[model samples]
Target: MSNSKLFILDDDRKTRDLLLAFLTYQGYDTTIVDNDVGFFDAPSPPPRTLITDLPTLLARMPNILKTGADNDLVVIAYDKAESARILPQDERWLFMPKPLNLDELESMVMRAQEYHALSSRNPDPPADEYPHFLCSTIIGKSRQMLHLFEMIEKVAESSATVLIQGESGTGKELAARAIHQLSGRSNRNFVPINCAAIPEDLLESELFGHVKGSFTGAYANRAGRFEIADKGTLFLDEIGDMKANLQVKLLRVLQTKEFEPVGSTRSQKVDVRIIAATNKNLEEQVANRDFREDLYYRLSVIPITMPPLRERREDIPLLISHFLGQFNRDKRRLVKGFSRESLEILCNYSWPGNVRELENLVERMVTIKESGFITPDDLPEKYLPTPSLAPSAPAGVSLPEPTGIEELPAAGICLNSAVDAFESRLIQLALARTGGNKKEAAALLNLKRTTLIEKLKKKNLQAS
Candidate 1:
C-alpha cells in the first residue's frame, strides 16, 4: 500500500520466488536480483532495504555497503545455521535463520523504515564533526560534551596551566590528553603520574629526578616526569592528594620552571606544561589548608570541569553505540545492539563510575552475549527497576502528607516560595522513584522531558 522498495537476492530459485511473492503481498515495491552483477551496476535508485542470503551478502560486502555511502540502507541476511560467523559488523545489518518467521521479518522491515524516517527528519551530525574520539577513547555528542570539546580546542591553542576537575572515571585525564594532542607540543612526550598512588617519600624523586646514591635504591641518575616531559605536557592526576611539603616544591617548579632533584643542589630548568586533574574539590582543600592556596591558583589558570553522566543523559545512547562498536570489534562478537527496554534502564541509572563503568558493561555484555541483541534480562540486578514500598523521594527531600489551607500560619506564608518548594519536592520524588532517569521521572510528573530538564536547571536540583 506504500511506496517503500525492497531488493531480494538469493541463489536458490524457489527461495527467490517465495520472497518475491510474500514481499509483494506485503505492499513493497519488490525486485529480484540473481547476483551482484546488475545489482551494483543498475542505474535505478537503490532500494531502502536489501534481503539476501549469507553467501551473496559476504561476497559483495564493503562494496555493497559502499563504506557508509549506503548507510541509510538496511540489509537483512538469512542463513541455515543462524551463525554470525564472518558477518560484517554494522548496526544496519541484521541476521536471521533460514527458516525465518514471516511476521518477525515484516516487523524488522517496519522498524527499519521507521528508523530511516526518523533519521531523515533529524539527521545527526557527521561522525567526524561530533563524537571526536581522543585516541579512540573519549566520545559524546551531548551539548555539555560538545561545549567541552570546544573548550579543549581553545585551550589547546594556549600554554596556560590547566586544572581538570571531575568525579573519578569522568575522563578528566582523557580531556588533558586531548589538549596535549591538539597542542603545538604534540610531537613531544606526554607524561602522566598519579600523585595519590605514589608515596610521599618517593613522589618528590618521581617528580624531580634523583641522582645516583641520592637515597636508598638510587642506583643511577634518572629522569623525572618533569625532565621526561620537557617541552611537552605533564599530567599530574589526583593533585589534591599531594602532601603539603611536596606541594611547596611543586609550586616552586610551577613558579620558576626550575627544580633541584632530590639530594642534588644543581638547579635544572625545564620548559614543561603542567596539566593537573583531581576528583576532590581543590578549592575546598585549599580553604581547609590541606592544599597550598598558591599552588591551587597556579594550577587553576584554565580550569575545566567534566560533567557527570547523569547530567548529560542525551549522550548515553551515543556512548553505548561507541562502546558496542569498540567491544564488538575487539572481542569479535556480533552484538547488533541493545533492546529498547535495556537502553532505557541503562540511560536512566546513575553512573557513579561514569564512562568507565559504561564501557565495562558493554564489553562484558558483548563477551557473554556473543551474538544477537541484548535484552533487559541480560542486565545486572542493580540496574533493574525494583519495587519500593517507601514513598519515593530524592536523598535530601521527604514526601509531605496532605495539608489543609485551614492550617495556614497566622503570620501568613510566602505563596510563591511555598509553591516552588512543593513543585521541587514532587520533582525530587519523581527523580528518586525513577532512579534519576529524567525521561521516566518526567513521565511520572506528567511533564515533558525538556520541561523537567528546564525545571531542574532553574531550581538547581540534583537527581540524587
Candidate 2:
C-alpha cells in the first residue's frame, strides 16, 4: 500500500500488533514477524526499515547489521535499557529507549527516508553529515529550532567557546547539553555551575579549585570546575552575574587555557570547552561597567540565543504532547492528552515563564487530574479563556491567591496591568518568604535564579 516497507520483531504480541498498526497508518507497508516463529529465516523481501526489540536483535545482532547494510536497510533498535548495548555504531542504525515515543519514532523514520533519498542522489555523503541530531528531548519542528539543531551539528566537532543567551527557563542549559552530547567529548563529564547562585567571594575557589588550607573551611586539596570539566564541557550558566574579578581570571583562562588553583602558584593546564549562558543583558552590563567587556568578547566566540517559548508557538503543541507522554509513563496512568480546546487555550496563552513553566504545569495536571482528557476547565484560572475556579487543589497545596480578581470597575482593567500586578506581588512574596535569598526565592517560585534577578533589576528593587 506504500512505497516503504517495515519489519518488526517482538516477543510481546501487543507490541507487535501496535507497531504494525501505527507504522501502517504512517504510510508504511508494514509486516510483523515473530522472533521464535522462523522470523530470521522468513523468505520475505528485505524491508527498508526494521524496528526490533533488544533480545531478538541481540541474538544475531552482528549478522543483522551486516545484512541490513548489504540490503540497504536502516535499523531502529529499541529496548527498556539493554538494547543500547547491542546497538550498532554503523551509519544505518538508530537507537531508541524503552517505551519508545511515537513522535521520535516518526522522526527517525523520516531520517531513514531521507537517507535513502540522499544515498540515491549521492552514493556516499560524509557519515557525520547524516541526521544524528534526533534527540527525543529536543522536540521542535519550527524553523528557528531546526536552525539551532543545524548549528549544533556544525559546531559540535570543534572546540570553540559557545555562548547561549536566552531568558531563564527557555532551556539554555538543554542547548548546552545538546552541544556537548553531539561533540567528541560526550563521553566526559559535563560539569555545570550557576554563576549567579554562588556567592561572589567563593566563586574563585569553585572555578579554580583550592589547595588545602587555602582559605576558611578549605579542608583538602580539591579540583575546581575547570579541572573536573577537563576533556569535556564546562557550562557556566548565568555567566552575566559572575563577579568582575572572576571575569578577569576567566578571560585569562580563555586566552592561555590554564589557571592556578587558589593559594597555589603552580599553573594547571586542561583541555575544556567553555559553554556560557545568561538571561541578563551582558552587553548592557558591559556598557555599564558591571561586566568585563573583554570577557564578554571572549565567551561570545559563537553566540546562540534561544528563542522564547512565545516566539516559537509552533513548538508548544509538540512540547505539550511530549510532556504528556512523559508524565503518563512516569505515573503509569492512561490519562488522555489535552482536548482540542485546551490545546488552543494553551497555545494562545503567553508563556512568560517559558518551557519550564509549561512543563511544571503539565506535571501538575497529570498528577492532579483524575479522569477525562485534559480539558480547558482543568487549567488554572489565569490560563483559562474565562475566569473560573479549577477543581480544588490537593491538600496542603497553596494555590495563588485570586485576590482582586473577582471585583472590577465598570470599564474593566487592562489584562496586561492586572497580570503584571499579580506577578509582581507573587515575586515579592516569594522573595520575602526566602528572606531575600534570590536562589531560594527562585526555587520557591519554580523559577531560575537569573530570572528572579532579572525581575528585580526590571523593577529597580534590587535593594529591597
Candidate 3:
C-alpha cells in the first residue's frame, strides 16, 4: 500500500512469475522486466527494490547506480554459486543463492521498505553541505554553526588576519585549522604556538627565532613560529595572555611582515598569515589597557565568534554520535549509543565546558561500558538532573495574578496578540531578573541564546 515499487529481471518465465505473484501479494506495485535493457527503460520513478539474476545485475550496474540516481535503491541479486565475491560492498545490496527462499526474500524486501521509509523521513544531509575539511572536524548543523562555516570559507579565500573568539573548549583552534586547510597555503606548514603556555622570557625567541649565542641556552640558530610558518598560517593560541612588551613586538610584525631574531640586527621578512584565538574578551582587555588596542584591531581583520554548546543544543546528538563512533573505533569497543532518557538529560543540561566536555564524557562512558547503550544510571551525578529547591516564584520576585475569562471585553480579543503580549512580558521579566545578561536570561526562560535574541529582534523589545 506504501509507494514502494518492485522490479524483477530474472529472465526465466517461472522465476519471474513467482517473484511477481509473491511481491504483488505482499502489497507491492510489481513490474516484470523481460530483459536487462528493459529494466533501464522501465519507468519515471525508479523501483524501490530490484530483484535480478547476478549476470543481469552486474551487466547493468553502471545504469542502476548511476550518478544522480536514487541513492535509496535496493538491489537483491541471486546466482547459483556464492555471488558475495562479485557484489559491490554497498549496504543497499543483498545476495541470495538461486534456490530462493520466499520467507528470506520477504524479509529482505521488508527491510528495504523500512530503510526507504526512514531515509525518506530523515535523510542524511548531503556530504557537500559543509566543507570537506569541516566534515571530519568541527561537527555542527545548527544555524549559528552553519553561519560560522560560511564565514570561515569566506575568510579562507583571503590572507587577512583572523580572530577567533569563544569560551574555552568551544573549538576555536579547530576553526583556525579549518581556515588554514581551506586556504591556498594548506600544502605548506600550519605552525601553532600557545602564547600562555610558553614562558614570557623565551616567548619572543620562540616566535621570531633565535641566533646561536643569542642567549645563554641558545646553542644553535633556531627558526621561530613566524619563520617556519612562511607562506602558511601561524595560529597564536591564547593571544590575550601575551605580555605588553611582546604585544608591541607582535604589532610591529603585523605592520611590516618582518621581524628580527633574538640578538640579531638583520631583519627577516616572511609571508605568514596570522590566526589568533582567545577565551578572553579582547574588547574588555583593550579598555583595561591590558592588551594593546592597535594589536587587537590588527588581529581582528576577520573576526569569528563561536557560540557555546548551550546556545546550539540541537547539535548535541550529532556530536554524541560522532564521538561515540570515534571512541568506539579507537578503544576497540562496541558501545551502541545513549539511551533516550540519558540523551534527553544530556541535551537539556548546561554544558559549561562545551564540545570538549561532551567528547570526554562519551569517551569515558565508551571505555567503561564497553558494549551497551548508556543508561541514565551509568552517567555521572553532575550530568543527572537534580530536583529544584527554589519555589516557582523566587524570593524577591512577585508573580502577576492570573487573568480570568470574565475580564475579557464583550468584543473579545485576538488570541495571537494576547499570546504575543504574554511572551513579551515573560522575556522582559527574564531579562530583568538576569540583569540584562542575555545568556543568563536565555537560561532563565528555558530558551537557546540565539532563539532569545531572535525573539527580541522580532518583538523589538529591549531589556527592562
Runs of candidate 1 with Cα error greater than 4 angstroms are 1-135, 390-464
**Residue pairs in collision within model 3:** none
Arrange candidates, best lDDT first: 3, 1, 2
Local lDDT at 137 for model 1: 59
**Model 1 global lDDT (CA atoms, 0 to 1):** 0.79
lDDT of 2 at 384: 57
Q: Tens digits of per-residue lDDT for model 3 on 309-424?
A: 98898999999999999999999999999999999999977787899999999999999999989999999977876532222332333333234333554555665666666677
lDDT of 2 by residue, 1-464 (tens): 22456778777788888888888887877787655355545566444677877475565767855675336577777863565566546657776666766655765665565445434443433444444234545767777777777767656766768889999798899899989999999999999999989999888999999999989899999999999999999999999888878888998998789999999999999899999999998889977999886677667656788998877888888898888888889987777889999998888766768899999999989988844699887888767543222323333433346453355545555665556656676776665544355776798789998888898787555413
Which predicted model would earn the best lDDT?
3
| lDDT of candidate 1 at residue 125, scale 0 to 100 | 49
Off by over 4 Å in 2: 1-134, 386-464
Model 1, TM vs. native = 0.59
